[model samples]
Target: MEDISIISMLLTAVFVLGCLYLVIIPFFKDETFLDHTRKSHTNGATKEALLTTLNEIEFEYKMEKLSESDYRQLKKQYESQVAKLMRDEETSTEKAIDRDLLAEVEREIEASIQQKSKKGGGK
Candidate 1:
């Protein structure tokens, strides 16, 4: 009876440990796989979604479903988000334009140098 009880207690401990390992292992593993599968929405898609949400909020407020203060607060938050998105889009556009201009300038400089070299070599 003593030996059986000891064996049973050891088995219970092992089972508990196994359960804990199953629960705790995820916390220790790399979470990049989750990120890899979860792609973020593009700026256009996100802007459209926000606009739709804003329209819905306006309709709800008109229907008297939301309090005036709540409507104002929500409107402010969504408007800020939209503004930030617009700013990000504009910044990205400006950076692209800058890069194109720089590339054009570099090409022009290279062409001028090559032309001078050819003229000097011929002389």
Candidate 2:
């Protein structure tokens, strides 16, 4: 009876530990996951808003609601902002790709070194 109780308690503890691990591991694995998601979402929303405003400005200008100078200035400003956001997004994407490629290359180099040492040692 005592042995049975101890085994049951051990199983219970293991189950609790497993549950805690599943719940807690993701937070540690990528602490910036939420931040990255929010930043991308905000950038997308801002870009969309700017595009919409640009369209509205064009429509207003066509309807003669804005002076020619004002319309040109607004169009230029919004176009510059949109261009900047696109450039920033592209740079970040390139950086992430570069990091991943670098990590893979490092892993391959390490693996090659290990294989060479193993073969040399066997001889």
Candidate 3:
């Protein structure tokens, strides 16, 4: 009975240590993970003023403030955001082009009808 009690105590200690490790490791890991993910999701930029945050990143990179791996990783992230921004910009411009074409077609049809009416009235 004493041997069984000692074994149970050791098992309980091991289980408690394992639980503590499981809880602590994840809390530390989450900080870095969340920061990287937040930097990745910045693909949304506005138009009309053209803001690019890459230069500041480069400056930090050149100053040796950031590690090589981090600089490369962050540069890649900014490039992706820029690509997404450009795609959205292109989409907006294409929509605008389509709108102008539609307006021009409407104006041309109205002009033709006006000319036809004038000719009929004159006759």
How much is the lDDT of residue 94 in candidate 3? 100
In model 2, which regions exceed 4 Å deviation? 1-35
lDDT of 1 by residue, 52-83 (tens): 99999999999999999999999999999999
| Candidate 3 runs further than 4 Å off | 1-52
Question: Which candidate leads in TM-score?
Answer: 2
- CA RMSD of all predictions: 7.8, 9.8, 15.6
* 1 versus 2: better lDDT goes to: 2
Pairs that collide in candidate 1 are: none
TM-score of 2: 0.67
The Cα local distance difference test for each model comes to 0.92, 0.97, 0.78
lDDT (tens digit, per residue) of candidate 2 on 1-123: 999999999999999999999998987786587887899999999999999999999999999999999999999999999999999999999999999999999999999999999999999
Q: Number of backbone collisions per candidate, in order?
A: 0, 0, 0
Clashing pairs in 3: none
> What order do candidates take by TM-score, descending?
2, 1, 3
Q: Rank the candidates by lDDT, best first.
A: 2, 1, 3
